[model samples]
Target: MFLAAMARPRYNSAGECTFDGKIGVWPYVEWVAAQKESKNRKRGTMELKPSTSVGKEKSREYLIKYVLPAIKEKWPEEDRWNTIFIQQDNAKTHVDVDDPYVLREARRGGWDIRMIFQPPNSPDTNGLDLGWFNSIQAMFQRKMPKDLPDIVKKVEESLEEYPHQRLNRIFLSHQACMREIIKHKGSIHYALPHLKKQSLEATGDLAIRLDIDLEYVEAARVFLATP
Candidate 1:
């Protein structure tokens, strides 16, 4: 999912916006035919492509062609001074971080872009997986797409309408989940901490950044050093 459908949220209480920045969604599927004709469309005619196995090569191309350019284009120009990290779940099809082509492309146009994998088996580490995807999935499910194209259209609609503030909160939750991981030595048994961000925001008390306590940082470091 990209930012094109909606604007990226501002961290402050004002809920101000930078721009109606959009990173358009890139569906990887090519049109394919329905085995049998359906009410939606004729058989063998153009339709949304189903997931046709994203191999490493395709992932690389996606990063190069779609993801990176979107970031460079949609990302706020003022915030381009630092590295941009695009996180992916630990999937086999994801390109290696150090892949030469990826590294080269990431450094293109003077941007310090990079890719990183979410912690294995830790869905909490992925903002989308933590909540956004589930929320969209629920909405998409309600659409009850009869065919793959319908599914794509419905899902795209779901994503486009998805609130940017909610997306930001999910990312905040993901950070809190990481803090929980540090406190628990990477254990998944920790409960999600409730921030009541909306209330905090109402009072202008919401923190834009979640600071990992010193002990929590030390704990994570020690745990990593032990192995």
Candidate 2:
């Protein structure tokens, strides 16, 4: 199973807030189970669960309770015996430097599991992130819930009814895309145009400016060192 963590802002519709409105954070934990085939082919299941919390601590607790257990239940029996690798990005909620629950679980499982962290700013590397937001958006479009309780109920219903086969098709497609990316030596930019476009569109204004400034500062340091 490949796992990825993402966050989307929660809004209060009764208060007439924007989609980006912050009623605290709703962190989503997505799990995809893939079965490999010959010649780099693969297909599998996908499960998405939204975990709510007013703060980071509560969020982590929610993941431990609701998300991880579901993942454990769905884990392939053979893979559990073999080396199980859990891949996730370096989100603060996902993995706190001081104490990461996933890592802790891996240790408790007698090192039967391994945790891999993707490179910074590399959401495309994880296929779960690719179609996750679209699924959430589709759910949101169906019914704009009045309050948190309504939103939670709607989200639960969506997850329970989400088609696993469709998710498998998506992962198989992503596996093919990944193979091509590997052929080009992991240059994600060249492999997936749609992912790049989605990533760019998702980036916020302040984040873009900060990234540009950071690049400039790093380049200036390199020039100084050369002199």
Candidate 3:
């Protein structure tokens, strides 16, 4: 499987899109020399094999060695020092926010990167689940990759071909979902909210951030305060 990371598309002071928000995608695989000749390759040919173990150590290594560098490299130069939060689901294999190696690498180049877990059992709150994974998967399915390497290549191509506007819409939907969760007293039973994002963008009326109603905020506060 591949691990992907992204952020909301960002614009510069001139309103020009500086970042398309595709941080990077990496596969959990390593090269190994074939012990014997196979139908696909000669003996001693190096082949990509998926990692046998994917636990905290592996996750930490990926974050420290790959994800962090990608984020720093692709993030806007002006915001390099900003506190960037990497949201992930609660998985046993995921690295802790306070992982020492992660902390050490994240703070390099004066960047402040942190990790946070999405709400438990709330897949809609994840931007990947909201749309990204599906978008890339749909595109790659049409490619009909012949092998592991081809699959990785096709997946990366799909990510490159994905429309930035659609990704922005996904992030908006993610924010809207969070608002719904808050408005419903932390319940995840609400229907998905539709913003007609494409139409709005066509009319040049797309909002960068969705606003939460004050009444909903107060209601949520009251709910939390109740004995």
Candidate 4:
């Protein structure tokens, strides 16, 4: 199944002892989708970091033109008919009230997509969102950006500096967690806590369980039959 995750990039400025900052930086939204493996294996992530600041119009265009197409390309031919599991946070840009254009277009596109929202204030449930941002923050922590352009440049530089092996490891870690969830019969709480802890430990034990027994008989049957 295609498991997707989304997050927003916030811009904050430093302030002096008794002074207020004047510049207000705009927010940027990012989305990533990956194929989940049996033993919590994950493929490379296809991500979208939009230039347009967070808004309905910008979000709509980016999703329709970029994110949707990238996700569509990743689905297997047989699984193309299956609904894409889009794990979305409670972001205003994602479920905007002002414009329903993106929703309408998404429905029209041949993407069988559904939003899987996490509980409010629950970042731990979404691992990739935490993983990617943490890597970026670690890379850029030594310097402060003066403006949006500077921020973007630093982000790009960090992305380049990041090793492919690190990303592959992240994807694999997420895949392992998803497998645990499936094994535990869609129980996010059961899988996430352990996965989070194991990720910090960096042990390859995450891939140990190849088959998780599904609570639903039909699900187990389908999973077994899928080859």
| Best-performing candidate as measured by lDDT | 3
Candidate 4, lDDT over the whole model: 0.43
Cα deviation of 182, candidate 3, in Å: 1.1
| Model 1 steric clash pairs | 3-22, 3-23, 4-22, 4-23
lDDT of 3 by residue, 117-195 (tens): 7778887867767676786667667666888988788777877887767777777787778789989999999999999
lDDT measured at residue 22 in model 4 versus the true structure, 0 to 100: 10
Q: Which scores greater on TM-score, model 2 or model 4? A: 2
Off by over 4 Å in 1: 1-8, 11-14, 19-24, 32-45, 201-204, 209-227
TM-score of each: 0.77, 0.53, 0.87, 0.49
* Alpha carbon lDDT of each predicted model: 0.60, 0.41, 0.72, 0.43
Candidate 3: C-alpha lDDT: 0.72
Clashing pairs for model 4 are 40-175, 40-176
**Relative to the unseen true structure, what is the C-alpha lDDT of residue 181 in candidate 3, on a scale of 0 to 100?**
93
Which stretches in model 4 have alpha-carbon errors above 4 Å?
Answer: 1-53, 74-78, 96-100, 145-147, 157-210, 213-227
Best of the two (1, 3) by lDDT: 3
How many residue pairs of model 4 clash at the backbone? Answer: 2
Candidate 2 weakest lDDT stretch, 10 residues:
218-227
Q: lDDT tens string, model 2, 1-227?
A: 11223212122334221221011123343344545445543565443334333344654554465444543554434334545444445555454533467557645655354445555666655544555546767877876877545665665555445444333333433444555667777766654534343344356211221233223321111000000
Worst ten in a row by lDDT for model 1: 218-227
RMSD to the hidden true structure, all candidates: 6.6, 20.3, 6.8, 18.0
Evaluation by TM-score, superior candidate among 1 and 2? 1
